[model samples]
Target: MDNDEPLESKTTEETETQPAPQSSDEMLYCEAEVPTPVDKEKAGRENSETDLEIEDTEKLFTTGQKELYTEACKLMGVVPVSCFLRNMEESYMNLNHHGLGPHGTKAIAIALVSNTTVISLEVADNCIMEEGTLSLVEMLQENYYLQELNISDNALGLEGAKIISEFLQRNSSSLFNLQLSGNNFKDDSAELLCQALSANYRIKEIDLSHNQFSDKGGELLGHMLALNVGLLSLDLSWNHLCSQAAMALSNGLKANITLKTLDLSMNGFGNEGAAALAEVLRLNSCLASLDISSNDISTEGVSKISKGLEFNESLKVLKLFLNPISIDGATLLILSIKKNPKSKMENLDISNVMVSEQFVKTLDGVYAVHPQLDVVYKSIQGLSVKKTILQWTNPMKLIQSYADQKEITILDFFKSLSATGAMKMSAGEFWKAMTKQNQVPLNRSQLRELTKRLEDSTGMVDFSVLSVAKP
Candidate 1:
């Protein structure tokens, strides 16, 4: 004790002079230095930075977005919905079949005014009228992020179309695809739209199908097509376009430089229209796909169209099916395609068109020049092309038998597959239903070929067509 303790021991007098021993906490407090002005400022700044980081990381909608949504809800007399706000974060917002009336549509449009994320907006079958359309037009003026807009099957009449056309004339640079199909647009609306489209150079695709656009409207669109340089695809199918209208559109093709696809199906593009298209095809080489199916194009029309095929080297897909083309006309078509050594044609759909044995032989010879060319036909005379057609008739017959045994019409049979009671069902779903449980004895490729015949451009099979179809 004397050796170890004497070296470190302090005198009693010195310890008393220093002060009483203190605890660790008391020592720390006595020795701690007070923060200076600079130190306090540094700590404040760090706390502020942390708050900002949390705010940015936790916030889902920006201030502008929140303001827009609040305003929309106020105008609609509804409370703000969290789900709707969540959709603001998505790139695509589909509100199809939501029964969003004029007010609802206008509200949604307002909410989208400040959106920076949404690029594709689908508001189809929403009962949108002039008011709703005007709101959208205004929103589009401020919102440039949206590039694709689908407002199909709305009641946007002439006034609505006029509003849209005006907006397009001024602000169409942001849009690449526009769908206005199934609207009640007439000739006047068509004229207005055509004028706007002529001025626009950014839109790549436009759908004006299933409207009331007649010859007068068609003629205006034709002139627009001639002037437009940015449009790559145009759909005028299921409209009231007639022979003169077809001729006008064909003339438009002569001057078009960017258009690659043109759909004039289910119109009355008769022989005169065919002749005009034929002449245009010979001159223009930009178009790659042309659909004139069910356009009332007859033997003479096919004959005239064949002449165009003789010289065409850019057309890859030609759909002349469902037309009243005769064996002689089809034979002439095959001959024209054969003569064109520079032809780049890949698909020739002459379905529902019967051909003679001689035409089949000639078609076989055409394959020598274009071995990759695929021809879709109904049947051949005195010979079977089952290998080529994938046994189209056999599948149809099997479907017909199933429908008969079920004691339901063919249309009903297809309709049964649709869960929504709609007149249409998906091609893939229909294929699965037909092939499921050995209902339709066919492989995947065979079913696909048959389904292609039954499906429309949307890849949906229309059961209504089955009512009048010949088994």
Candidate 2:
């Protein structure tokens, strides 16, 4: 959760031809993955779990369910990522309870078997079980085309994990970007995958977060990683990987040369574990990004990591958020980064590091001097929907937040609405009034829903929703 891929836009043209992979050993790394819960999206939008809308030009057939799969393949070739094949504006593929039994997996399997152009696929959150995954495995066994496969949030249980791991050990699958996050990959089954990982370097990027990978699983991962040569990015966050696992992974990094990004956030890697990992940063030159955020790393660990940074030449992003690294620790770390003239650091996230206001102000001055080294040192907290609405609805508050010089007030806002000379109005009327001559964030129906929420009895304006003070 520290950093993520760029957001996808639906308006972007889908017909734009995507260049095919150069290597016969097609790489499977891309920006699409398992689906996560988003806001109920815009109010105007219908239920966001509808089927994908294929373009007229991309349709190859219009038969039964088979055509849907064929059309999916036709549209998918436009982008390397199958997830991006979706129209960003439309509702996403949300098949929680409706896994379609065996038919859903067969549809995708048929598409994969027939199409050789498609590379990346994101079929996560479908609650797919052994049958669906086994169906995919069967197709992938003969497939040299599939590079990326995201089957996260499915029911790929212990047996399934063992099955996939054993399959990978045979070098039959060519998947490069494989994400198995949120599947119950427990210790014994996880170890099977780790054993396979020792020999299989075909996978370049993998996400095994939010599973049951603990210190015991970490030991297996560490032993394999020491000999791993092809893996560039690894995400092991939120798996309860404690200090012992951190130390083991750190030991693996000492001899690792291919790993560039490692996310150890949301784990329990304390200072003792971080101190062990610090040595790799000192010796390894290939690592480009490291996320130790949400760990209880204090000054002692920061001091050691800073020493490693002195010798690091390729490290870029260092996320140390949610730690106990107070002002003194941050100051020492910042000074160490300054000493590394060869450091290609683009951003450092030290947010919620228990720093004082004065220390943050000083860090801001440093950030101003070295704009390339952007420092994020803020606390991230959640807000209620009602509170968010109240603040956003206030015209003066919104204008001030945007830093616009146009002096608009609550009175002016009401007067502008009154220009139409109607005290009571429908959401449709309010939508037109609010979106006059400019693009508002809300859709047409969203504007109407907001009007409904704020209007009082007899459809009179609440006025209170728009009464927040400008910052």
Candidate 3:
């Protein structure tokens, strides 16, 4: 009987007396004994209650919704989403990029009036013009179930803004989130919307990016932010807010207490604007996140912001990516955060900017004090000191030319290079892609510079912006 020797087989009688072998599934429920009569009765009652609850949930979609769905399907020449008809208990309906034009949008709007199950709805990039928006506004006025709505890129210009403004003015508490980006809303429409927002107090978040809002509109909206007490998040990126406008906005934010997140990226907010925002940061304690990437903020502006960061305790996330703030500016930020012993700062995004070794060492020391703080960047001190054959040139033109030569849309080109099938790619990935192709004829230094020039606060290059720039 050596340890490695095989055991003998059991006798037939002994095998018969042994317990039966159990499968994995049986082993899992080995302790689950047969229920007693009383236990069975309790389980039956619980199952009956669950059945009744399910039935009630199914009834949330009423006969009215069925009739509306039928009518809408016929008018739109397409079946309504299963969430409306079949899965009547669903709370979200996403119809983004469905090519639902004005007619289809109106038909859907008519059906949505009776939809009590849906709480969040998305109909973005559907080509729903002003006519469709009018129908939606009418539906929104009547329908009270929807709490979140997205109708971005619907070509709903000034008229649509006015319609939405009227809705907001009247709406007491139903809607909580809104997305109105790329709607061509100008200063006048912005003023009207701001006035409406000022009066209404239910909306918690809003996106007004890619619009035509200038200094005047920015001022009005800033005034609205000062008065509005319910808003928690506001995005005004890719607009025309300059020094004066930004200063006005910052001044207004001094009095606000509820707003937590603010994005003003891709604006003309230079050093002057940064100086004003510095004042805001020093005083405002409610703001948790602020993004001002690509606002032409230089070392001087960073100095101002650094001074603010020394005193700021509530701000958690700061994105200064794509600014001309060199290593010196990054160092200032690190020192500023370190100086603030009570700093609640969590994320500091200086992506696409090259940092010096000294700056990196200082950031490491700051990490000792604030273990939760994250500093995001792509390039190091070596890249900053490299000499280039040619002076810095705009790579956007080359990218556009490459798209043309490839005989594909700009979006398609970017999507082809993107690993996630999105319109954006990381700076490192983009540079690698550029190196593999002669379509974008540029040297290594140029490629590195291109990545830095295009990347946003998250170190992502959004190539789809080129498509929007096209006619």
Candidate 4:
């Protein structure tokens, strides 16, 4: 959409003999590069201190911005509709510690508080540390009109996160999107952020990626993920989430149906974690895009993820870039896709996979069968043949079956399976089956705990006493 190619010419080209369907030859095909938008007015406008209650006007404006005092005076009470405080020169992710200083942030905060029409605020990459964040929260508390907030890439440490989290709890802020990515947030800080995320129902998209989170963030992730149905996308890439953390998120995601895009790339979630997430995919049908690239996963993890693909119908984009999935892993993924009649995946990225030349030839054959789908890999050849794509299955029809069974009845049925004079079974099998049957009124964690308790190696006795009642 950002391309400058004329629509008329594109239409005319399409009207002409339609080009034969082509498959992707390169790993990165048709990757559209969007040129960054440059606002001449904002770029040229001198950064002078806008009219605010704060004193010291002389030191407020930088020497180069001294002349813009007249313009600043005119734009007094009603600042503007959208505020662009982002440093255009710096890359989005490159922001380390460059942002509006405390003084500048404070001044802007004071002015923005009174401005009722100001909807969106973008103050990213300005090293607005704790002091600036405190000042911003002051605005967030009073001004409910502000909808979008971007204070990303600032080295706002633990104190900053605490302030923001505490402020969010007190006030009903109207923010729909929050960008706090690469803020050097610690585990404790991320824990604080989870509260804000769960409370803010208006929030739809959030970026907490590259925060180096640990158990602190993972502990409350299930509750956080479960609370936000409005959220569409979440970025937690490069957060160093271990198997425990990954499992926590997977359990949370078991009931989530709104989140569409998730980026968990570079986290060290091994096969165990990936397998747990696969179980999540069996129940969730809303997530459309998923990225678990560069997580040091092996064929086992890949196989588990492929199994998830077999059950997931909404997923369209999968990124497995720079992982240790070899030819065997690739085969598992391919076979899984082939098995799933309801898989909606159209784009798959498998760059840097360890595969044989024969496997590459196999992909060529797959391309010949499914030319429309973009299957990107290191060694791929374009070909045109019969249309092939994963078709929808009867899963949507069976969705009601998951909920239709009465929880109490299912609990009793499982109890009967291991009851007096019935088939002698392990306590773990009975508990596992009971949990599977009792999906309602119980979160994934609760079910898992029951199953785990039953799995105790000491040959656990009676699970009939376990309560699966609605809380």
Give the best candidate by TM-score: 1
| TM-score for candidate 4, residues paired by index | 0.59
lDDT scores in order = 0.73, 0.64, 0.74, 0.60
Q: Any runs in candidate 2 off by more than 4 Å, and if so which? A: 1-98, 354-371, 379-471
Which residue pairs come into collision in candidate 4? 98-125, 98-126, 98-127, 99-126, 99-127, 100-126
Task: Give Cα distance to truth, residue 115, candidate 1, Å.
Answer: 2.3
250 Cα displacement, candidate 2 (Å): 0.4
Q: Candidate 2's residue-wise lDDT over 18-103, tens digit each?
A: 34444322322231212222112111213212212333424424433334553343333311223322322222332233232333
Cand. 1 Cα-lDDT: 0.73
Q: Please provide, for model 4 over 105-154, each residue's C-alpha lDDT reduced to its tens digit, 9 standing for 90 to 100.
A: 55456555545566767777776777668777776766687787888878
Colliding pairs, model 2: none
Off by over 4 Å in 1: 1-71, 78-87, 381-471
Pitting candidate 1 against candidate 3, the one with the higher TM-score is 1
In the range 1-471, model 3's lDDT, one tens digit per residue, is 021111111512122222343443331211222224312321121232231111234333554565555444333333233333443447987767655666556656766766678898888887788766876776776678989999998878888888789889986538899999988889988988999989778899999999999999989988998999889999999999999899989988999999999999999999999999999999999998999999999999999999999999899889998999888888889899999998988678888887777777888688667754668876666654344224556666677777788787766766776567677875545654665556666644456556666678665787766666753
Candidate maximizing lDDT: 3
In model 1, the Cα lDDT at residue 442 comes to 63
Tens-digit per-residue lDDT, 1-471, candidate 1: 111111011421122212232343322111122124312321122232231111233232544565465444333433333334557789988777655666556667767765789999998887878767877877787678999999999978898889889888885449889999999999989989999999898789899899999999888998998999889999989999898898888888899999998888998988998999999889998998899999888898899999999999788778988899888888888789899998877678888987767777788788666754667777666665556465445666777898788777777766666567568765535644654445546643466566777888665776777778776
Native-structure RMSD, model 1: 22.4
Error of 4 at 130 (Å): 2.1
